[model samples]
Target: MRITPRPPETVAPADIDLFDPERFRSGDQHGAWRTLRETAPVWWHERAGQSGFWCVTRYAECERVLKDYRNFSSEHGTILASVGAPDPAGGATISLMDPPRHTALRTQAMRSFSHTVVRNRTPRVTARVAALVDRLGEGEQDLAELARSLPMAVTGELMGIEEQYWDRLAHWSAVGLTPEDPAFAVGASTAATLSTSHHEIFACFMEIIAHKRANPGDDLISALIALAPGGRPMDDGTLLLNCYSFMAGANSTTPHVINHTVLALAERPDLWRSVAADETLVPALVEEGARWTSTPYHLVRRAVNDVVLAGVPIAAGDWVCAWLPSANRDESVFADPYEFSLRTLPSPHLGFGAGPHYCIGAPLSRMALGVFFRELVRRFDGVDITAPPQHLYSNWINGFSSVPVRARRRPAVASSMPAAREGACAHGTS
Candidate 1:
């Protein structure tokens, strides 16, 4: 008689070490996302001790939910419900806010983030990327150290936060994003992490705000300081809220684009080779890498009214999350969804989000990554992954925590030596 092996106990995507934060931080969990994206395009998941939610796993549906924000409002919490500390100062969750109000604030921000401003910074951003890569010396370097720093430096410049405050800002951002970890919530022998960091960092923003008020400049801080809508100055509450929003937006997303793009290209020699052959391919690489990077995995939305999605009923007050990363890999929308292809055109990935609330800094982030990666492949002779890339301690943002790389290139080689650089590798980032 033949006895079959026992099947492993199936775990829900919401529960499958997905929220442990540490697992993602350490790079242990993988592949359930692919399974979810395929089998349960939009499935309901239940978590122990907290409210469950509908996980939207396909690109077609994810785009629908994100673009039609009116039907699926995001004004509540953006992801899973917290059995932990909620933001103490929470008035409106900016990321989750519905439009009209969201539109007003976003418009104010667009004035500072317009296309020309980002284009002007490209050279400086390219210089930073070059210097950082040149410093690598073909040895194992923490991708986080270089990748994380570039975005923080840019945020520091944009926010007037100063270099001395950069590390502290990074710390708060990690804590602020990673709530299930020991950082955010207060408990026995500890105070709420958000409370502690909010007071300290918000105070720092206060100084910047005050300084800009007295002596304005071309930076975002000064622009926000001087901006008044409808002939009334923005109140202190809205002002602080907008400032904090910018910090959360830029610092969280930009670094991920850089870290994951490099990791993705290093893992897939073909795309790297394309960039090596033609630096112009950098833009496509940037788009596809970011498309694959999968930041803001799910944009959770509250049902604004009774709505039907793909014939499924969504009751008002119910929470639904659009699984964008899963969507990007949807086999329906993509051909051989898991493979990295820089040549794929008319690509429709939801990494920067979609519709009215689509990320305002997208053009900036895209240009920066394209230039950075182009310069890297152009300069380095050999770029290889030395160790498995690690991911951050959050479920909301799908990005690398660490990507160990060994990029080989003759330091003194001619600037235009080879038409292509990536020779051997495997994997994708967006």
Candidate 2:
């Protein structure tokens, strides 16, 4: 089942409601985003009985808002759900805090995701992805399941989270992000589902933190426990909130990028064949995949003071959202932005975002994607979609909940190639 790309719609600013998850589900939102980018770059999005927000769609404007942390505060919230109210995790978690404090905590957190650490872990990640890819049998398989497992495995190991808790944490992370989706909803109301999932994750992390305190290890939690920023240790609440932030950030986004990329390849078999013939193209393929997916679709920030963006006046205390997918597709920044081609080297897409809040896990994410796709094309001739992807019903996360596919396993003779044999055995011995 080849999924046809949705064409952009000619929508007026008044018809656009960035808060509606349904539009994203139907792919109509792409048209709306396109319209907003071309016509109203800085749009005041208003809906009945809900607070309005300044939606910045163009690349230049979105980059400006995200980088200008002093003028726009994240403490209020980083998603539309917290509009008109301060985020509960505000000031405690890295994503929700502004600079000085955010700077200190992020600096400490960076220790876990440093380039050296990620590079050292590459062989292990490659091995893990290879094993997972190898498990896919030839008939039909849900690529989403494979996509979901890799991140949890890599991130859980880094945090020293026990394997027994990985599955539940992955589920809770999904639920916490998209409580409105019936597939992930745990309770009657969206609020209840969100609360339940968050509570479960927090409780689970508390248990892990307790264990780490008694028996420290070389992991993120243990590192944070030992950290003394500015001569003061991070409090329990802040520590716990950061743990949640780390897990959610790791588990939620990367999997979707995997799904979207695989699905894109499935749709374009010619591209898949090209990638299969050349191993070196994998890196560019990974970059193109990240740019095309733009999984963490939009990030919300509140204005600290009155500001002018794109000739539009945004009042102090107003909500401002930077649509990453739109910015990535901005014609000015990317040539033929919508085309999923490997030619765009050094992609300037805001897939990981920009400035102070750029994703810390980006290196790990790129490594995982590169390994997965490189191994995937080598092990399988190609993949065929068996059903249309079921996209998550959320404005925040742009991903599929299910992508049913049938793998075409490569012939055994193909494994005789030196590159194929090398990739198969590339897993590091730890």
Candidate 3:
């Protein structure tokens, strides 16, 4: 199935700039993406003083680029910030490597984030999520702030990080990914902020690595310390880079998924009531939320060999970016792509990505979302959006810096009633 091409007059292609943070912040990127997807699914994006790249917006093309790692190398970089330059951490970090090494490192890391591991940790995760949910006041509260603490708390103890350092790590991860956002700008400039964040996070990991080396525990860091993938032990540089990768991956996307889910529910009262009445639907909601949010909006890969994508000839060493959010909303792949519906089960959306480089932390992120929403529906009757969400100023992460919400506690009677009875009551049919 092919997307119906839109009229050329409808979209001003010259004004579209995929690298501009303001396009995303102003929410104009969605329209631009739609235009691109329909008109030029595989289009060249040029910028003055920088090398141009191909933008893959449709579902099939995006998936093809991600899965075809041989032709499209990640060794150069995985974000536009490093475009036209080699990433120092490229071959060393798990996120920036190709197979064999990538496979070995991911296999070692997968043990800690496996479904069994996440399942075992669920009870504790649920307890923590419940406690956090219980602490919310009745009036307006920043859901973004509440969401930020979750991934750190869940992954921190799993990684043997001290509880006191979770908040700091979360802050640094946010800043590192989206330093251009004023909310995270502590240094003189965006580059300075990014440098400071990277320095602090690496230093923190170094200290943790030293402690783990002395007092090894049943945790990820310790396991990595013991792991000798390919008969070569990991050096501190590799360890620190992977540690930063893990922390950033764990902390960045899940919170935005949570915040976006709540905000979506708040806007759709009927959907909120349905999920609130039936906790079983929470999993479906979680899946749909991940699809809807599509955080980490785009991923960049440099072509290792010349290849033709969607009829467009891409040359060797040319950078290619797959717009994940755009792919998730492709008209041919999703029916009513713009609408948020829980019925989109068995979702083929590239939310966690596709192929060998798929996110290793996916199971952990899914577990956190499931536990959080289950606890949320049990405690809250409904949530209301108090104001517009403050979106993060970055083309990389499709997330909010602030989401003000007012939640109403579930009534005592409603809490005690059965699911069917609660549904009936919610509909005023009793």
Candidate 4:
């Protein structure tokens, strides 16, 4: 989608500048969003120079926005920064397209992520997780380092990226998502860093695409290239955008979920012990973590026509954002919304979102998380959080760049030396 200059619409009430990145940086947005969900389900945020947008904070309203794409259309953009951008990849990309087009494009990519595909790929995921666990040191280490690196390497394998290029891919993805974070910056300024990273990412994909065209493989890149959607080969630009989307979608959110999962478990050794005892609970715990973390906080959409959401009038051509964190924490939907628990299995979490634009990598993400956590339990009895988690500086994404922790490998007291001695004595006597 090309960036287009949009005329300022009628000003929304200045209750809060939801666009203010500082709210997220300070980690105060959750409280603010919770309050809005109760008091004002549909709140408007006006940026000083930029046009204001409506925020749907309630679960019902957010779901309505997601499902009613006819009114709340992604044709404009699905991300805050891309709205009104001339080249939003509206028609070409699955994410930015509406019903008919979106359905078709999504179908093309959906096959690669089907139940069978993910099921067949489980062994690879398990091996990857086990290898990662093997590399963990005995004492204090940054859990976030493993959290950040492991997902990228696994996702890189899925995308057919060379092992050597995994770090570069992670760096580009980090800069792309959190350009505001100085740690991710490539140059002196965030803007320059984002620009350089985006250009490099696109250039790298161009080389990959060229190579894939020459030599087809089992990778997603080759699969997309081989596909003739509507009996015509997809254009190179659209293909490149899809490649970027896959990388961003797969690499950005999962690490945060993993980090948050580790932190949550570390806080409750009882819960950790339970998971270590029964590996079957790992999948449920993974879902709960995704809900609790709300990694992908919100997704943006534009109003196709004037519509009232939860009694709030949204004008045609206005922007609408669905705050996933607020929805995930909706009291009406989730019992004890703020409290995280494995019992909240099969949660209707909006972490992957809802409706047509739901995350395509949901299955893969779940598989990867389950494998990681199960392997974690096998290797470590528990985690000891070493320091406070450092969150990423974006309102769009609820993620942490660093969460320090130590992986403790000792078996529980119940199953340690005494039990081992008894077993040895029994075996010798027998």
Give the local distance difference test score of model 3.
0.83
TM-score of 1: 0.83
lDDT of each: 0.65, 0.84, 0.83, 0.75
Tell me which residue pairs clash in candidate 3: none
Report how far off residue 342 is in candidate 4 (Å).
0.9
> Per-residue alpha-carbon lDDT of model 4 for 1-430, expressed as tens digits?
1111111122234435567667676544665676677678898776677777788888999899999989988877777776556345776777778887778778867777777888877666666665666455447776666767766656665566667667777777888889887667777887888889889888888888898899887778888888776788888998898888888887678888888777777767788889878988888898888887786778888997989888888899888889887798888998877666786467788888889988888998898888788777766778667777777788777777777777777555423333224433543311
Per-residue lDDT tens digits for candidate 1, residues 1-430, read 1111111233465555445556556543336566666566667666678766776777878888888877877666566543133333333434646777667656777866788888776555555555566656547787665766666555566556666777777767656654445534443322466567667668777777887788887777777667765466776666676777778777667777777666656656676766778877777878777776677666777677888877678777777877676777766777765666674555788888888778887877777677667667767765667766656667676665566777687566544433122211111100
Candidate 4 Cα outliers beyond 4 Å, as residue runs: 1-15, 83-87, 412-430
State the TM-score for model 3: 0.92
Q: Looking at candidate 3, what is the lDDT of residue 133?
A: 69
Candidate 4 minimal-lDDT segment of 10 residues: 1-10
Clashes of each: 15, 0, 0, 12
When sorted by TM-score, best at the front, the candidate numbers are 2, 3, 4, 1
Superior candidate under TM-score, 3 versus 4: 3
Residue 246, candidate 4: C-alpha displacement in angstroms:
0.7
Q: Please give the lDDT score at residue 118 for candidate 2.
A: 89
| Global Cα lDDT for candidate 2 | 0.84
